[model samples]
Target: MPSRRQVLALLAALPAVLGLPEEARAAEPDVTAGPDWDATDIAVLKGVLAAVYGPNSDRCDAVEALTASFAWLDGERKALVRMLPSLFDQASRVLVPTISAFHDLDPVQQQACVDDWAASPLAFRRQIFGALRQLLLAHAYADPATWPDIDYPGPWLGRYELPIHPLRFGDPELP
Candidate 1:
């Protein structure tokens, strides 16, 4: 019973109404240049990392490295990185509503807040904790400075001892 004009109007609006090309609608913020984390946010992240890792260790350096690495990450990982600041900020409030921010709290309070997230039953909280852990721990331990503490021998300096062999896909001796 719709008029010709009405039908044409609906057809023209169909894409927007039905949310076609969902990716366009769901496009994440561009963090290609780097994460938008400010000094306060970075400090908060450092505090969280201190709690997750150990205080005054290499965590601050690892955090700086992780922040710097955001620029080279793909869009999905960049989006994840972007979420971290807001998520931590919100968690700070949820954990201590009276505090102005997570970093404002004492080290023990900050650790407790981070512990809450680490022990959370929600998958998102757990995911955030896991991501922070993996990022900080990976960067911290991978640094050459920490190698001495862990007794890790530095990168091998030995050159190739074995001569290179050409590929032989079907050779019976390959196994």
Candidate 2:
């Protein structure tokens, strides 16, 4: 039979093996998420701006593509956070105007607009790109997976039933 000391020693070593205590681990060199913003995930916002309004502007298409590509990332960030209400507000503002503008254009004109925007000089693309980066950065920090299940936004498709038996409550008397 193993001695008590041996068991205790093994148990002590178990944490090391499993990496149970995160703080005890040796520090790793911090790496930025990407080239665009800054050390604190701000760069993600910057990258979005760069892709959009930079010298080769693709602000219209790039914003849409970036948002679409990061659909999963959106879930990671969740919809409403208190601290970033202003930032979210800003994004909402841009999205509203841009979405309105996009819809207003005829289909062919919209396509041409996007194509033209994509081909624009890099400088102009930066305008809307930063907001995109902010979105991605927020998602990483917020970790939307931890959010609780919420009812669907607009409405429920079907009726909800209470668990009580029908007999528990007598049917309404005929008028």
> Of the candidates shown, which would achieve the greatest TM-score relative to the real structure?
1
- Scored by CA lDDT, what does every candidate get? 0.73, 0.39
lDDT of 2 by residue, 1-175 (tens): 8899999988778857896654553343223221222232333233333333333332224333333444333332433221232342243334433443432444444344444444446553433333444554443324323222322233233456546566655678844
TM-score of each: 0.65, 0.21
Model 1, 1-175: lDDT tens per residue?
A: 9999999988777768887654664575544587878887787777777777674564237777888888888867777776776677667687544455676778888777777777888897788778877887787777776676768887665644666677677667767
Least lDDT summed over 10 consecutive residues: which range in candidate 1? 22-31
RMSD of 1: 9.2
Tell me the lDDT of candidate 2.
Answer: 0.39
